[model samples]
Target chain A: MAAAVETASHIRAARRGSIRGSRRKALFWSYFFLVLFVVIFLAPPFYMLITSLKSSGEISAQVNPWWVFHPTLENYLGLLTEPNFVTFFRNSAVVSLCVVAISMLISVPAAFALARMKFWGSATLATGVFLTYLIPESLLFIPFFRIFAFLRDITGIEFLNHWWVLIIVYPTLSVPFCTWILISYFASIPKELDEAALIDGAGYIQMLTKIFIPVALPGIIAATIFAFTVAWADFLYPLAFTTSADQLVLPVGIVTTLIKGDVYNWGQIMAGSLICAAPPLIIYAFLMDYYIAGLTAGATKG
Target chain B: MAEAVMSGVRAPAARRSSLRAIARRKPMIAFMMALPLILLILLLVVYPALYSIHLATLNRSMKRFVGFGNFLFLFKRDTFWMVVKQSVIFACTAVFFKTLIGIFLANFVHTIPTKGQRKWRGMLMVSWVIPTAISSITWFWLFDPSYSAFNWLLAKFFGTAPIPWLGEPLWARFCVILVNIWAGTPFFMIMYLAALKSVPEQLYEAAAIDGANWWQRLWYVTLPMMRNIISITVLFSLIVTFANFDIVRILTNGGPVDQTQIFATWAFQVGIQGNDIPLGASVSLFMFPILGVSAYFILRGVRRRSQEI
Candidate 1:
């Protein structure tokens, strides 16, 4: 009881003294590290920007490396005009967008059911869904490759080196995690809200469309962003599956097309790497709150 | 008291619920909602995982059953055990540093003012959100032998020759670990920071009033409060790092005499590069024990925590 009284008084004193001498020191330290941390985090992309602005001769000059003699936008313009780079970006965008759409269609309702419903195997299935997220794509790639080969044999339609191949593969990553988060977010909502809607003679589909989706907008956005970023930035699947220039995603295309046999085009490679990283970086910079919310949703549920 | 009486008056008229109507219909609705998820898991996840098991057992490359020959062949290889050792080393070391650094960073971030805290929080999360493949490419450039900025900086600062980050065996392993730490630690930091916020301020205030030093307060109050969270985060990191593929793949491609090869990359090499699918399956199967143990602990921890709550 004395400890409790002392604690209450101490808290009051701390609140009173928050504007006093030692607090400023703490504030300064916090801001100082915050700035330093920001710089450390942001430096690589800054270095990439500088590298992208330099010419190949400048980049490899063996002189003072940090400063460019002649800053040029030539690499950026040249890369934009490069026929294969454009195709790669377009293919990546299309594949990523389609994967997002597909993941949402499957995951949102499934997450809702697991979160809100009580079925015989619902809980077990939820765990099963999360376990799929844990299966590394590296392990699955060879089997998937063989399955595609078999598909070609039976259907006389080749799935290899096709952009649409990702539409089939990307779901393997997105759905499980998306379902997991959606389930968590869905569970947090009050049951009475849904019950009221049900009592109003709203069908399951209508209630989902009208209520749950709107309420869970942040979680949905997080899942969509995750799917887009994963599909956009995937390397192994594209490296293993797609052989053609036209079919490649940004990550694989930049590496394969730019790096020739025993020779590295340092300028174009850095430039392409920067370009590929930009969208996700920009999105992350702006939408970090929603992203963190989405990420920790799983931790809470698990 | 007045509001309680008012609500009680309205409660009786709203009690027209039929038990059978509610019980039978709700189960049907729940099942209907869950159908797509069940089908997807069965078709996509269960089938593929089970199919891989069957593939692991047999040597049916040309529709022929070679029995346990694949496992026998894998057991006889020298590199298989080396890969296992390296994977455990990589996962343990990376998870250890990531969890430690993450906790420290989270504590540092948590003590800051709210307005400043959010900005730093967002900045730190960039490492986690910047698609792993794209950032791995950037790291590849940093470790590039000829024109790497990191090597350039190291040379300028230390007055030493440029380090062959990707070409040397031990250095290549270290570089991958560094890159993995860079990419992964933010995930733990965020989780810990969220856990930190849930801790009540009164606990700290009480410790302060008792004349406990900062370290003692942390040991007594913070550690006890965040212990479960720390374990969960570490276990999660262990599973992820054990199965990691992209960073090692992009950075080294498991080269420099295969010095840095972990299980996933080794599996890829054997299966895809060496054209030995059965051997690859055996190598990939090695990941099961690590994941299985971590998953069991995580689930049990989760259950204990849930029951406590």
Candidate 2:
């Protein structure tokens, strides 16, 4: 009777074991595809890295394109030492920084007022802010040309090709979206904190500067990062306006300078792109939480 | 402590005005705060947009008034029709694939253990972190005819002939759309993952207890939960993808007999490069109607949510 009971218990244990084994198999397959996608997603940038490490002569038709035979710092160093690389880097840095500052200055208070303060047409204006974010830069550059010409016709400030003009044009893109994102963010904060201050006899300006701005810092960081990335990554405006090499931003500068006259310097071109991509990549790497928070908040809520 | 608190309390009677006075002041205060932003939008966006419409009405030299003349000329061109078709195909196909692949990838990543989730998310987001122009440049080299990495692999493994990724017309369009999907999929992945996280775990457990299978649970619970996010993400991506210029410009530049030209590039070519600003403005203005419809929905959503707040 004891042996029979033991055998029955053993059978139950074996059945449970098989179910666990199947679950393990399911997980193995799931991870298999996950790693597969990781490789696929990473391939292009990985290819750039390997190609950038290779010697110029080694990137020919016959060589194995997968690995670098003679890994060298030439591509990266050569890019840095290129005549206008420093200028491009500096220009991008200045523009991105200035755009971020300008975007924050304009967007923060506006978003606060729109989110919290009641006014006639504030809702309409908030909707309009979101609408402007939808307007593509593609439509704007043509009119930018005409507008600059019109400015030249009147104010005589030939706005085209001037690097600072981007400082002006980029805010149109950044402000509406940044303000929209902040509106959502500022709206998310509990009303009692500010209401408490209002009861404490805090004036509106004091509440905004001392309370709202301090509280909405995360959204501000997100907007700053977004504006910086847009400024750094912008191609068309710089391309359309800034033809001179010194005035160009990194993305535009790298393309026009590195890929010259059909004799493509694949090595330097790859390296240049990698460098051009570095600022945003570094910001994304370090502050990914804030970045995603901003993107989704801007999308889902705003 | 009582004295300190009392000092703070006494200021309200001196500072807190009556309700009607505060109500009167609120609009004035809000308007003052919003003035800088409003001025920036008007000067940069509204004024320039109005100027584009005016420019579209004039001749090439900006000297003659020619109503609908630029639009008439664009309608007559075969290339313009080609751009219209290609733009639609590119935006639709790219957005569709990105959404599909994003859902799959997001679901897969969501199922993994929490410890591994953050690392994988960071890795996946790297694609989006890199600028599109930079990544597209990398792809341009990968699609290079002679030293193409993709071709080299196909030849080595499958004994396939060298494929001209950017040389032929169809392949060129494919290359541009493919790069767009690669860059954009990460965005959808992360956003959907966030939405997936918000789904109540109890609902899934309840569905399972009711004997619903995986597909049934996804259909009945997950899809219903994620409906709003899916539509908005699609609309947002559609506008951006439809107006895309960088990837195509870098990869193909409307080449192989203008088969790949979208409105943006074609406009840049004619208006900026070809020195016909009026025609270019007209081409860009065509994007407004399609995008205006999409924007209306998004703005309505934003306005509704703000009202809720």
Candidate 3:
């Protein structure tokens, strides 16, 4: 009986050990892939950073490519101090800020109305807003170019090559998504809060400013972040409409100005790209929750 | 006392009547509130969309009527056929890889304890947060000849010859799609993770209690619960990916015999640069049918989602 008891305990111990061993093996594979994915996802930017730190002469030399033999910050300094680069930076900043403001101004109230108020065609209008967001820039740029010219002829607005022209055009991209996100956000707000305000004879504007806006603050921040990113990162419109260096945004500016006659000033080029990327990256780093909320809400919440 | 009572009764009734008036005028109020956004959309989105169709019908100079002529011209060209095939391939491949890898990564991330998930997700989304132009151009530099990091790494491990990453037609197309997958997959990961969270834990527990294995639980419970989100995300991604311009434009610009040309870049090349507006407009219109289908699905998904909530 003692031997049988001992044998039974041994078998149970072995079974538990095997289960633990299998879990360990599963965890090992999971981390292995996780590390591998981190490297793959991060390699390009990491490489870009290393490349940016290397001097041009070092880059072209037959030397170790991964590590910087001779590091320098000339690329960053040079690009930053350059006049055209400054202009591009300024244009991107201005356009992004104004677009954020415009998108919020337009979307917040519209979303509130759609979410809270009962009106004819509201549902259809909501769908329309979504569909408009889906209409890609590629489809619009062509007609937009032609229309800009037509407007130039009729309205005397020199929109074809102006930096300010982007302000008018970018709302098309930002407003629909902003409105959609805001609508979902507004709808999700507890109806009781706003309903109580309504019962107290509060005006819609008062209810919006005093109640809905404060409650839906996270949603508003997400929308603003989204609009800012969209406007700042827009490459095609800047590339198409703005021909002169002075009018270019950072993306178009770097690509066009840095590459000159078959030679890529790669150090400076990578530096410019990284510099342009820093704003959004920094924003993402700090406000990741809001950013992710916006991204997922922009798609799934709708 | 009587006067005070009369005043009190009159005040509440008067306030109630005013509230009624406000509610009655809510339609006009809503309409007025929505007016600026409506006008903005009507001007920018609606007008331009209709204008694009009209532009497609016009000749290059915008003076002549050529209904269906430009589109017919496109149908006859070998390049147009290639563009159509290539666009479909690019969008479909990118979307497929993104969705698959996204689910995998999302599942992996989901497996971790909640505290670790955010850190891992932030790291993964690095590519997505960076502007596409910057990242795509970064890939362009990485894939540059004479010192391609990828080729060097490939040679190190696989002992292969230098890859013409953006030089060869097949590799160029593959590179573009790979970049799209890289940048796009994180979005799917986050969205899928959100969708996955909505799946009730009890379902999985019940499935396990019933002898359903890991795969079975995922297939029956997780996927079915996530169907709405999956469809919506894929549909939205399809539209975006189909109309994707930044990756192809920055990476190859439809070079190496225009092998990676999609509608956006092709339209830019032919219409804006080549000064053939009609052809460009016609090229861009090819995207509408596909997008229309995707949008329809997305709207349906949104409606269903809102209804559920």
Candidate 4:
């Protein structure tokens, strides 16, 4: 009787183990779909890498169009060594860095005031600032062209096709959004910190420097990254404003120089693009969480 | 101890700490702190925007007021109507797909346990955080007629004829919209995911206990719960897609035959390319009313929901 009972129990355990194995297979299929989704989404950049690595002849001959052959570093080498590409990179770096510095200079204090001070029209002004983001860059270019022309004529200082032209243009894009983000972050800080600082006879400036700046460091970093990326990757403004190859940023630079008229130098074009995309890709790989936090803050608040 | 406590309260009360005293001292410092941003916005955004409007009304030479003549001329053009229709089509179709796919993906990803959440979330955000212009170029390459991997894959899998992804007008429009959707949907995915996480599991549990299936649970519990985020995201996406220029420009440069010309691209053509400043301003300014209405509803919806929550 004991032997029969033990055999029956073992059979039951075996059946249960197989059923559990099938359930695991179902979960695997579900994960497979998610993995496939990522591959499809990531195809363009991956394809870009392959194309950038191929030689011009291979790209043109179209032998197994998806595969890279005679893998060469020629295009990257050429791009990096080219004087014009170097100039474009330099100009982009300068514009992006300056925009970050200038944007922070303006946005931080404005955020402080809006968060702390009970000023007249402060709420109205905050809303107004966000509305500025709705205005497209396409609209701004024409008026900018005319205004710059007028400035050149009056002040005898030529602003068109110059790097400094971006210095003037970028703030229009960065300042409003940065201020809104900074304001939101500052407001979320506890009121007691400022009260304690005030009790210590710390002035507003002292409080901003001593209390707010260190606390809101992540928001500031996120804003800086934003300002940098906007100034770096902006295409329309550079396309319209800068006609000179020497003055162009990466986006307009690669398109105009490599793919002209009807002939696309696909290999070199892809190579130039990868170089241009490197910085932001690196920034993103490191700081993606902070970036998303900054972007969604407005939505959550609104 | 009682005497010391009384002395402390009396000593603190002996000094005047009036609101007027604080304001009198810190008003200058507050203004000083705020002065830079005020000046920057005034010079850059506020002044240029107003100046642009002023310049749009006046003649090209700015010597005389044209008095809506440029706007009138814009209305007279055949291309303007074509652009309007195309813009609506682009924004609506793109927003539709983005919201649909975004919500679907969010739901799919959410079915996984919390431990597996971060991996998928990171993958979804990859498309979003990459700079727009760079990714647009990558898409541009992928849609190239003679050498697109998308077509190559299609050929390999199905033995189909090569479709001119950007050569034909309708196909070109579809391609542009497809790329726009691809680039944009990740944004919606993240937003929906955040909203989905906030949805209490008890509602789903209660619904399931009452005999609701997956579809029913999604319809009743998920949809209603995510309504505010959905509406706001749709509105915001609509606005951005309408104003979008990069994807369209990079993909087809406004088309095989101006078939993909939305308002923003059309504005670029007429304003800067055609040297018709007033016309471009008028075209761009057309976006204002739609933007205003959407902004109103979105802000109101958010406020109402937040109060409820």
Model 4 ranges with Cα > 4 A deviation: A1-33, B1-20, B59-63, B305-309
TM-score of chain B of 2: 0.91
Query: Could you give candidate 4's per-residue lDDT for residues B145-212 as a string of tens digits?
Result: 88777788889899888888888989988988888887888889888888898899899767755656
**Ranking of all predicted structures according to lDDT, beginning with the best and ending with the worst:** 3, 2, 4, 1
Error of 4 at A57 (Å): 1.3
Q: Which candidate is the best by lDDT?
A: 3
- Residue A146 in model 3: lDDT: 88
Report the C-alpha lDDT of model 2 over B92-150, residue by residue, as the tens digit: 99999999988878877877788898888888888888988889899999999889999
Error of 4 at A128 (Å): 1.4
Q: How many Å off is the CA of B278 in candidate 1?
A: 1.6
Calculate the i-RMS of every candidate, to one decimal place. 6.7, 7.0, 8.4, 8.0
- As a whole number from 0 to 100, the lDDT of residue B159 in candidate 1 is 78
lDDT of 2: 0.84
Q: Ten consecutive residues with minimal summed lDDT in candidate 3 chain A? A: A18-27
**What is the C-alpha lDDT profile of model 1 across A1-302, one tens digit per residue?**
99999999998788657534444665566577667766766666666777788888888888666666788888888899999999999998899999999899989887776676556666677777766777777667767766788789999999998988988888888888888888777766766777677677666688789998999899998888888888887877887789888899888888778886877766677788888888888888777778788987676653
Give per-residue lDDT, candidate 2, residue A13.
78
Which CAPRI quality tier does the interface of model 4 achieve? acceptable
Q: Listing every candidate in turn, what is its Cα RMSD in Å to the true structure after a full C-alpha superposition?
A: 5.3, 5.2, 5.7, 6.4
Candidate 2 lDDT over A68-126, as tens digits, reads 87899899988778779889889888998999999988999898888877666776787
Error of 2 at B84 (Å): 0.7
